[model samples]
Target: MSVRRTVTVSITPEQDALLCAFLASGRYRSISEVMRSALRLLERDEAATLTAMRRPVAHDEASRG
Candidate 1:
């Protein structure tokens, strides 16, 4: 089984409303599911950014020799 932990978060009324709307739309079963999906997207974007930053510049490589 996977390990799980509980976390506390604070959000503005507007944000809460958005989460409620998502639930009402039937796309997500719970607020936690919505938050988890959002976090996964964020993780993917950050990983892509880090991968891009680690790539060598083609022009710089040509100037070396």
Candidate 2:
């Protein structure tokens, strides 16, 4: 089963208008879809950051024995 979540946040006037225009154009069915896309990108970027943090250097550096 997919977990459903809700978030409440704020945006600037220009940001709000831009999102409203996107919804009005029917490009996105709902505000949730727009937020989901933004969050998904955040998740991917976060994962990349975590992986890089864990592996600071490659094995080539370890081979200098």
Candidate 3:
């Protein structure tokens, strides 16, 4: 079974309206799906950022001599 959490957020009226449209169009089963997709996108972006940050240093860089 899948569990869920409650997350509250604020956004511009325009953004909220857009989400409503998505729901009304049946593009998503619930507002939760929209949020889930957004969070997954953020997770992917964060992982990419961490990987880039851990990339090897330049050849000119060296430890204290």
Candidate 4:
């Protein structure tokens, strides 16, 4: 139940080489797969950061109670 779109992005030669390396390793099937996996990691990291930021400190909780 998700919509997918094709996006064209410009990257430096070094970045392209990195992606090619991943492909050569036979770990990722294509550039899209590599990008998706990276995005998943980024999303997880951001979610964890946001959760930590929203968490209340023990001292703050004691003051409020």
| Candidate 4 structure quality by residue, lDDT tens digits, 14-56 | 9999999999999999999999999999999999999999998
Q: Rank candidates by lDDT, best first.
A: 4, 1, 2, 3
How badly does each model clash, as a count of residue pairs? 0, 0, 0, 0
Off by over 4 Å in 2: 1-6, 24-26, 58-65
Q: lDDT score, residue 11, model 2? A: 95
**Residue pairs in steric clash, candidate 3?**
none
Task: Choose 1 or 4, whichever is better by TM-score.
Answer: 4
TM-score of each: 0.77, 0.63, 0.67, 0.77
What would you estimate as the lDDT of candidate 4? 0.97
Best of the two (2, 4) by lDDT? 4
List candidate 3 segments past 4 Å from native.
57-65
Model 4 residue 43 distance off true place after TM-score fit, in angstroms: 0.6
lDDT of 3 by residue, 1-65 (tens): 68877878899999899889889998898888888888899999999999988987665366532
Largest TM-score belongs to which candidate? 4
Cα-based lDDT for every prediction: 0.96, 0.88, 0.86, 0.97
Residue-wise C-alpha lDDT for candidate 1, range 1-65, written one tens digit per residue: 68978899999999999999999999999999999999999999999999989999899999996
Task: Please report the candidate that would top lDDT against the real structure.
Answer: 4
